[model samples]
Target: MDFWQWYVRRGRIDRRTWWLQYALPIGVLSVLALMADVALGNSSLESIATGETGYGPIVTLVGLLALPASVSSGATRLHDRGMSAWWLLIGLVPLFGQITLLVLTGFLRGDGGPNRYGPPPSAAPTAGPYLQPEPAPEPDRPPYWG
Candidate 1:
């Protein structure tokens, strides 16, 4: 599915997808557990590296926590726009670059209303933010009086 499609389906950015999508990265880190065997064999990278390095694990855990769904959805968005998922690094550009990238991704203009992705979102008339509110009705009078 396209980005907008994914976005609408998911409704909101979430953590479950992050874990699934980033399974590879987390698997790589799990290799760290092997350090114990290496240490026992006197062939470890660091014999005394203990007390939970803290940052690396914390960061990895957080990334894994958010990888599965979010990353997949983000990729869909890029594909919908004929852009590369790597372009998501635009988040690292600092200041306006990040904001611009966010705006583009957050809003799905769709592919000409119906591109290779699929049909527009049901083609229903969407309410715009600028729509004027309906005026309040006055106190009711008898129908016969009117």
Candidate 2:
């Protein structure tokens, strides 16, 4: 899938894909922020913790860009589990809510088939009707079996 569809689209996303989408950008951005901190002559975590502002703007900008995409992907992941997008608000409820959302989105399997959100993420797109083949004819059988 395209990056936009994978990260920004409001549709279903299975757990495996959700985990990757959720973790990758956060991990990459954290590493980049650490590198920027080091290049600026600050002790990475200590600088951030001490309220140093050197790398803050860079980190803030990257975080602003990533936040919406992260929320969108998370909402879609919730949809895959047959839950409403509103479930994302649970993260605002403090530590317990955040932990609950993590467990629900990261560990639970999605609904078994097509759901209100859409088909399973792994399903192939359907071709036009003209591309479909006719059903095979039935074979002749003995009268007793019939």
Candidate 3:
């Protein structure tokens, strides 16, 4: 699937694919969080801590990288439900939005087994119609590398 299409499509990703999709951004964020904690310590009060320089720029950069992936993840989740990605805005309604997003994230609808997004859940094991078929195996020769 293309990146955006993969991002959409109903249902929680199987563990393997989920790790591939989220691991990098999450790992980077974790590293950044670790660095922030090391630099700033875990002080609850902001006023008493020694201010660290140069972290602002780094934190901003990491946030920019992470935010798009996060948005993509959320949008894809909505797409999985056959809903438009814009529905992610439901997360903007204060506590209501939080509850809505929680319900949406916890939902497990599986694209009704496949609609415009791609093949049905049962068909996922086979190539979806959009895929190009592999060349037939040759009896007299090794398979084509191209």
Candidate 4:
């Protein structure tokens, strides 16, 4: 599916893709937002570290924007392990549960073949009905010989 469709719960995603594609990007954005806030003097390092008055505006916006996608990514990763998205509720139990989920989705391998969540992730997102890459135009001539 296309990139946006990749955020849905219908697919499976292996650990590498989960980290590199989804998690890292969001994390990078959050860090950048924090940097901007600090540079702009909207928040200080101490405040950000303690979250005394909560996250700065930019970081808050970034988190809000990324929340749905993050949840879906975690759910799809759980699907890769042949578990329901409901398993993510384990994060509610506190630190241990969160760590368990992190290991399950961020370190363990997915099923070798198809399970309930369909085939293993194909590495890159494929085209979907709404968005797709256009075919490249054919060269008028093959090439010139050296």
18-96 per-residue lDDT for model 1 (tens digits)? 3343334455545654444454453443433653323344334545654554566665555555566687777778887
| CA lDDT, every model vs. true structure | 0.50, 0.78, 0.59, 0.83
TM-score of each: 0.36, 0.72, 0.52, 0.76
Q: Please provide, for model 3 over 1-146, each residue's C-alpha lDDT reduced to its tens digit, 9 standing for 90 to 100.
A: 67765434454343234346664556668577646755764432243245543344445566666666666666655556666778878888999997887576444554656655555434555656678787689899988777
User: Between which residue pairs do clashes occur in model 1?
Assistant: 17-67, 17-68, 17-69, 18-66, 18-67, 18-68, 18-69, 19-68, 20-68, 21-68
RMSD of each: 11.8, 6.8, 7.4, 7.0
TM-score of 1: 0.36
Error of 2 at 122 (Å): 2.7
Q: Across residues 53-106, which tens digit of lDDT does each residue of candidate 2 receive?
A: 446556667777778777888898889988998999999999999999989888
Candidate 4 lDDT, tens digit per residue, 18-89?
A: 898888999899999989888888889897578686677898898998888888999999999899999988
Off by more than 4 A, model 4? 1-3, 122-146
**In model 2, how large is the Cα lDDT of residue 33?**
72
- Please state the error at residue 137 of candidate 1 in Å: 43
Clashing pairs in 3: 7-76, 9-80, 10-80, 113-120
- Which of the numbered candidates is closest to the native, going by highest lDDT? 4
lDDT of 3: 0.59
Point to the candidate with the largest TM-score. 4
